[model samples]
Target: MVIGPRQDRRPTMNDVAARAQVGLRTVSRYVNGMTNINPEMAERIRSAIEELGYRRNLAAASIRPGQTSGVIGLVIGDLANPYWAALARSVESVAAETGLLLTIASSEEDGARHDWVVERLLQQQVDMIIDVAPRTVGRSWSHWSPPLPPVVFVDRPGDLAGADTVLADNRGGTRDAVAALLAGGARRIAFVGDDRALHTMDERYEGYLLAHAQHGVVVDPTLVFETSHSSGQAVDLVARLLREGRADALFAANNRAAVGALLAFRTVGTRLPIIGFDDFEAAPLFDPPLSVVAQDVEAMGRAAVRAGLDRLQGDDGPARVQVLPTTLQLRGSERP
Candidate 1:
């Protein structure tokens, strides 16, 4: 039998102590932020820690009584989306204010992945969790029993009971977009969106119908398309609709679908009226600037963090939902 060094092992505190020529207690004190050590000794320990690349185990430290992990876990759907990215930035800003570390995970709207990420966050003993629930996973929190840490839902609310939720006004935003198109003299407006199973998509679709009804304009079922939230799929769907000349204007329910529709129109050298939900980068730079229904993403993020903090502070009140408003930003794209 041959014996070799353990290549997988991380450098331990004992290694740091030996390198610093200090007692183990001195190393422990330095790692724990104790101020009783001499300056010279502290310098030696710091140098040793740097040289050995020592990292304190936050999970182990949090296990001690009265010690908190000071970490918040955030789970979002599709970090690639600009809306989700902005929301994350807001959450990070608030977490910084509280001096808590934030760990972010992308579930990609997959139920299994969302569950797995939540379990991992719990294992790390995070102070709380902020999540944008997966489209298919309703009531995900029911799987876990009592003593669960505080959780706040953002963007989309799942069936998690007694948890606070923060969401944009999806239905009203879409309705406003449709109404604007109508006022601009668009008689045949097309609606493109993600799967209807998602709460956001369903709400937006409802708003589309309501806007048409209010204006005494009947919607054409053929002009409305629902796909798997893919930009390429959206491009293909919108291209078919354009080829058929079915719509005088378009309402894209989300950012990705909007980009797809834009590409489809650009491909055919046609500039039909368009309005989209969720503003993204360079939206104003198009040939005709894209109009959008803009949500206060940063405010939503801040509100989520505040709600989580409140729960941590022993506010056992009934669950609350915060529905923030959206605004229409017109830059000539809504005009026919």
Candidate 2:
């Protein structure tokens, strides 16, 4: 029997196609994760594939004509967070223009998870990397570089040591928001944000301090709240502040923390003026509409992808820290 490896060559797509009585194109599409496979035929093809021990040579398939130029790997802190999700969508859209597939992985704000995700993407030979909200990798990223792909930081700014970055105008926008609040008669404003170790968080905090100094408003260190970037912790801290009567206005540093503080305020039935860093859904629908420093999240994503593609095309463009502008929108929450 021609059963040993020496006698029987490994099963290929052709063998599976022959066994399933399906066209080569049908089997090809199934293996490539493409759609349009009927349920019954898909089941039959899968069974035949298993029976024949057929495995796709992904490396070979990746370089086929009209096939993917490998994947554009995106690593973000959290997919549930709207900023990262919007960024991922934008990256996918831009990558589509270059005929590259997008593979997104969420680190959930953990440094180890971020490292693992990037390593896995590297193993798969992604064409490029985009990291949004990376924690500890910023300083040492240059030391651990990928062989073929270049890494780009998105949303959260970092000194990636030669890596490109796309970030929102965090400091200027926060200062503007604080100025608006001061003008609205909000004297007792409290700052709530993530750990100061984060680059964007630190920048936003600096803006807040700068605004306070400019307006001759004293920074009451007692009113500043810092959490470990936890949604529940943000909610708890905001709720505690409301109970203690420390703040008449709140400035949320990031979107998730902002949403959590909003939820806490709603639960407490407080209508204190609130301005969030990132605009979110249903902000206008709340009893008191929310004021926010809104970044062009989609644009940031597209810019990151564009930068990566440009580098991939052998462009000797200067490595830039592209900071998109942020807008402060007036809402009922900031009106009074």
Candidate 3:
């Protein structure tokens, strides 16, 4: 009878040891890259490993002291969003430089899905996690407890006390955008933004208020609208505001909302001064190129990766909230 190892079974170190006619410890040392093996024995083990298609199990190897699976995980609100996509690419680039693999998942802005995706990443034994947390629905970070790897938050802060965070100066950016519109003689400025529950949006809204306060302009509450993270909804809301001549200028607090506002303005043929936060792919190609408060997404991504790596390296320092500056891009749309 010519029986052999199961075809479906992956070859293991034991199989390599048997095929090499060596002790299991010898095979272990060879696989783990330890030195001091006989040249002939090393040759036999190498040949056996190649012949059997044997691969080191990284998950198992990570259990040892000073070892890692060499994988990092990123959780973001939506990968389809250009801002998040850019951030992911930046993180991927940095990770590639260090020979670390990155695994990314989108939460779709659902709090439950966010928790589920995080749990799955944890199961994969990632060395660390970088997250751009989703807006929760009636839930706070204080309520949930899941064993987590070293985590660095990007774009938004999480409820975990002392968790490292990298973010843009949301308030300063929006304040500057509003100030620009006011400088261009825009009164009755309208503010459109994502969910009020989101910290990022809230900060932008605060900036809108602060700018008006500083400039001695009273903000009309009727001109501000907070909607779901939907461009279509933003279009509808903005279209109504424009048609009714309720707002002479608009400040869209996100890329998606800005797109919606653009479409609405085009349909109504209203060339109202507009400033958007988070520049998008087509922002510069509009009839009058869109002006924006551009966040340093690449820097945010790089900083998040560095923070996670620092935590992994046992920095154990005080948690940091690094806020990168945002720049106002005056691309003609802000001119009144």
Candidate 4:
């Protein structure tokens, strides 16, 4: 439909400007979420749009030749998991400040689903994507062609060449947590994790190994268990491990694994010494309290968005792999 004054059509930006007593450009800038609009002018535009019941043509704006969609796509591993949920919230906060909408999708921690998620995001033609999902097995980004949109990865880094990534000190944090367990006389520590395919899990496992090597404790290969990121699976694995009678303590590579381990404790009536990878709000409130190596997820989220925005602003420099630090929170659980 041609956009003009029409009695039988919905309200348009032109109608909004007329009602607000402002220039069309001013109304356009305000409606498009430009940050420079004067407060008084913004109020008038807001009131006029509300009163006129004006709805923006977001589809047209997204496809405009010389403008951005002002939207960012975010694909995380699993939205139900607290860790990814918290990270997405942080990304949303940052996106809001830039007047950009954040569209979040979950890959369900499956590689095939991850491929589909990225493809869907690309089809939406978002300005950029913040990838917090587990990368597909082998080389990631093979599903998408070159000249892709600006992409920023978090946690596990993306395999796309020259893609910016924000990573926590996974190896170091795991090593520290494991070493502390060792120092507390906890040997035969059962190492539990999600799919070994995840880069974050690989890093955490390496840290677990490093701690054992540093302490001169021989690592039993049989003690390591790889399972999906689920508490129920963890309960089964932990129960079996407990039945075998080899586990002295437990080191969970990620929050899901940690949750699984905790659930297993309840099932088997045995609370093995455990040090988890992520920190939750109720961790300290647990019966024995929880110990964990906490990643600065909020910072990682902020950095990922900042890098993507920079790339959008024509930053063509070599992709920077930013590594943020983690903190070891020692409650009573790590001691077993």
Tens-place lDDT per residue, model 2, 58-89, is 67775454444468999988778877777788
RMSD of each: 4.7, 7.3, 2.3, 4.4
Q: What is the TM-score of each candidate against the true structure?
A: 0.84, 0.79, 0.93, 0.85
The runs of at least 3 residues in candidate 4 whose Cα sits more than 4 Å from the true structure, single-residue gaps closed, are 1-8, 12-55, 135-147
Sequence-dependent TM-score of model 1: 0.84
Best by TM-score: 3
Write the residue-wise lDDT of candidate 4 on 1-336 in tens digits: 322346688899989898878899999999767989888989988988887789898767866655677789998978888999999999999999999999999977667887777888877778899986564552368558855789998987777888899999999999999999999999899899876778888888999999999999999988887774687788788888887888899998877778777887888888888999999888898879999999998999999999999998899999999999999999999775
- Ranking 2 against 4 by TM-score, winner: 4
TM-score of 3: 0.93
Q: What C-alpha lDDT do the candidate models reach, one value each? A: 0.88, 0.80, 0.87, 0.86
lDDT, model 3, position 164: 97
Tell me model 2's lDDT, rounded to 2 decimals: 0.80
Query: What CA RMSD would candidate 2 show?
Result: 7.3
**lDDT of each residue in 211-240, candidate 3, tens digit only:** 999899999998888883788998899889
